[model samples]
Target: MTNPAAAALIARSNRLGADPKNTNYAGGNTSAKGVETDPVTGEPVELLWVKGSGGDLGTLTEPGLAVLRLDRMRSLVDVYPGIDREDEMVAAFDYCLHGKGGAAPSIDTAMHGLVDAAHVDHLHPDSGIAIATAADGEALTKEIFGDRVVWVPWRRPGFQLGLDIAEIKHRNPQAIGCILGGHGITAWGDTSEEAEAHSLMIIDTAADYIAENSRAEPFGPALEGYAALPPAERRARAAALAPTIRGIASADRPMVGHYTDSDEVLDFLAHAEHPRLAALGTSCPDHFLRTKVKPLVLDLPPTAPVEESLARLHDLAVAYREDYQAYYDRHATPDSPAIRGKDPLIVLVPGVGMFSFGKDKQTARVAGEFYVNAINVMRGAEGLSSYQPIDETEKFRIEYWALEEAKLQRMPKPKPLATRVALVTGAASGIGRATAQKLAAEGACVVIADLSLEKAQEAAREIGGADVAVGVQVDVSDEAAVQAAVDAAVLAFGGVDLVVNNAGLSLSRSLMETTEQDWDLQHDVMAKGSFLVAKATAKVMIEQQLGGDIVYISSKNAIFAGPNNVAYGAAKADQAHQVRLLAAELGEHGIKVNGVNPDGVVQGSGIFASGWGANRAAVYGVEEEDLGKFYAQRTILRREVLPDHIANAVFVLCGPELTHTTGLHIPVDAGVAAAFLR
Candidate 1:
């Protein structure tokens, strides 16, 4: 418990694990061994402290480090005298624990314990792996690192690999580190600082060598973000590809979160022979454990027709899954359970960058981040020599390792709206923005659509976190823009699970004073816009074959024709009617449609911010600031109907609360008797 050597090792592991480039997620483990007094007998015994299996080193504490009897662990390996350990070796690990303080030792404990040094730091830095995964890796290590490094051939990590490393070290005796071909390197010293610093130094030297020797070639970029592509081509490509990829990735589970790559991805896939090279596998054994042996390489020609693109994407996905299954079948042992996810972690599209997905945005983003680093690794490794990662069989060992599978099992369950996507029109401000925020908070990925693309983007940023929200410029009256917005939502978030038709324009002039032009403007935006959004998004919902909800933001004036509120009221009335019509048509498709009619919400609303409040307040003989109070007092409940109130009502309809209700209108006008729903 008081070993300074073990404490230092734990601190070093945290530092190394904190950087993904140094070691992939939960991939590498470190160790320190020293003599300690037994708690019960006060007898001096040599103990080995190693990182526990399935724990992230970056956040690992002293307790997460396992202490084992050095003699017990070493004795088990000595008796085996074999290249690999069978399943029974797991039992020996428990018997060797110094105390209950240490949990199950990492699968690599035998390998760590075999090293004779007082401290050992094992890492899978991409820079070092860039060299280790090369065809000429063994020679290159000696050439770059000189006699300081010993080269070991790829061995399946277990008791045998531990014995092999020990034998290699005994023979060399002087090398500070050993390079495990197609895997990672291990560095050791008498102290944690020496081992940790030298480990990083070796990695840095390899990176410098690659940078100075390898000349990077320039290649054309791919279609990554929608804003990066031509407007006319953006929606079509995104709509056809995103959902198809989603369908492929979500064969067993929904892909609620997706991540599109950037220009670095384009540069990786731009090589003439990238398709073949990418299939070789990840740059290191650690990355292979996470991203599978290789990414799914696809062909997405920019000029292909929409129908052809869909077919092509679908066919490629099918082939990728089949290929993955074949890989699993070829390497799988009868004792090993099937590898958890058959889906490829990274999908590489030539001239189209890469795509990654997960159950949620953060996970998907993590996948993207790791894959991006993978590209860098491959580039550096290939530049030195041919990129040659560990063989597929070795990959299967790590990928299906019982320890690795346990991590996935430990993941938390999904949230209520997990894997669902929602679109909120006019989301740049007020009620729609509130609704979008609410949906995202409940676990649904949100798409924010507004007339101003800039404002839409601003709103998305303020309510930001990656993959949770995207901004789309949509003038809901324009059929093309409306369709694009819906498709954009589907493209960015996999599919549309809910809709909020909240975009509308006001024309509160009396019918006699209202111009034909004024009437058409209000009708086109409020009535027609709502119809367009619902129609386009409904098609996506139907295609998904998942029941969804659509709610319209109607006005209380729809229920009563108030003074100087003809055009606005008429438009709202038609908009309200569309809710019922949509419910009637889409109910068979399992889409429930509803409406929320609120009186006045002046705070932060564009209706008030854009000067409409001045005229309304003048008519009511009160200042503009008092308009909100006026509406509040007019309601029988005598309460203010805030934007959040409307947002709350819409959320209820979107969730299970109103799953059985449709063709319904909910009034959030506090207590407007005439506006009360029947």
Candidate 2:
């Protein structure tokens, strides 16, 4: 039986074909299909569809419509091709469809079949065409829509690509559409109109953004790596390297073709101007889970000091491991398993494109995708600044989270810390407010202590939950005030099981011109204040026979001294030391102490607004408007630290999950500490 929508779709395709700009031969095509189910039988009865093939959509018609039995077509593809036959396979596929009283379907029939939606439409809109043409196009898409759209890199279009799309749809049932690298877009919806509207929106938005932004220049020539090597030598090196990669990889390694001739490849090898190349085309979180933050960028020249190069790569790997270990040490539960090993998922030899090694296919695939996305994102963000990921420590905790494991247990509504009480200092804003909110959310009664009484009350009001949180005004540096606040918290919440010392002031001054008064002031606020809070909180926790979590808010400056900020640096340095001392002394009393040293955390607190933000802008002699971009450019992840990021760390440290963790300083600086050494 004929479907009205299918007929209209055929007419629309023919009309579109007449428009010159819309009728580009090789650029894109549109397809529409109808879905119907028998009423009592409740099964798909027919698929009447028009699929545009080689002909331009602008000049297409009913003749371009391919009619076929959907069920029969599915059966043909079910037991599809194996490795050996190529031409024979193609001939067989064509013969079966044509001989079965069906016209040739769209080349994208396999992909369309994967969608569960009643109507599916695919097109390479002009706007998408412009975006896909750029080197960092995929990243630009993410920067704009993030997870709202799924992205698939360019793959040789056919069965394999179809399978990939099918898997993606299965994984993400709610995806609006997907953008194909160097291709166009595929959109699906319950109705034809909805799908078309989604496609139009994606393309129009992408095109508008591209038009507003400057066009990207073509990538320069690739640098030299294997291209400089003799042909035989290059093949031998590849063969030799293949086994090592395979041995460590979770699955069979695919042979990587060497770029011994392309000038673009050679240029990329010879220089590090394009760090994105090392990361590009990798899948998301997959690459991150397997390979970690950054892959090693190997320099192949003999004169480049092979030992130094290897050492640098090894150092990068070691740093990743150390950061991971530190994160685990800070947030691991007493019952959590130990971390296994540290091996990067992917490596980039100067001359080679990329080598992804993983414990399994899933890991390798994830690693590859992450690197690819990172590359594209970095490239796109380069125009604005750079794409900075979260810190190594933060990533590690997320990757090896104990709570994530706990989720696997599927225990029902078990409160791990039902009777616990927590005290959060500087709870009026920033990390403190976030921690207080988190603790209350997790069923712990909380005390919000802040210098500003109004802000404290506001914060307490915001963290509204069954677990009550009360505000207390206290100057942490004033010993009497801190003691009183702690005492009040104990009276209100019954006792304290957690203490988050997140209150501190930042005072920036050059060492040469720094006043002793400023140095003392910084020390009093950060170090002395933390000590008083710990001392007061410890009494309540110890008396209650409850081991508690005490977290100090340090800074990236603590590790790498800040420039023109001697007072702030000195105070942070001391704060870190105090954490260690507190951990040691409090251990006997079953108390845990830790520090969260965040780098470049912006927003939330007025620390940056009153301290670094105001001062750094003046120091750089730039307008306040430009400081954010300036700082963003200077960092690796290029992400400004949000208060939630820091607060999340504190939550992990204080939660029942970290019962065994203590005496550690975790850096939430997005690898800024390593940047200093680099």
Highest TM-score model number: 1
Return the top candidate by lDDT. 1
lDDT of 1: 0.78
**lDDT measured at residue 433 in model 2 versus the true structure, 0 to 100:** 84
Error of 2 at 516 (Å): 2.9
Clashes of each: 0, 40
lDDT by residue (tens digit), candidate 1, 252-281:
666664546477675666556566667787
What 10-residue stretch in candidate 2 is worst by lDDT? 250-259
What is the TM-score of each predicted model, taking all chains together?
A: 0.79, 0.39
Q: What tens digits encode model 2's per-residue C-alpha lDDT throughout 1-678?
A: 446767666555554445432323322445555556655578766564636334446656566656544565556556666422221333333533321243455445656654566555566454554455355666777876676668887653455566677677778776787777655577776666676667666766774665466325323344544344554444334333332332222112221111122333334444545555454322222235445545555545523444464455545555655654665677666665566444445556554345564322223433454444444433433333333333444455445644334433443663444446678888888778887887777666778999998988888888863236779999988998987787566434334678888888776668887888888888888889988998877875664444668889888777785578888888888988899998999999888999898876656766777766778778877777677666666677776667788878887887667778989887776667452422
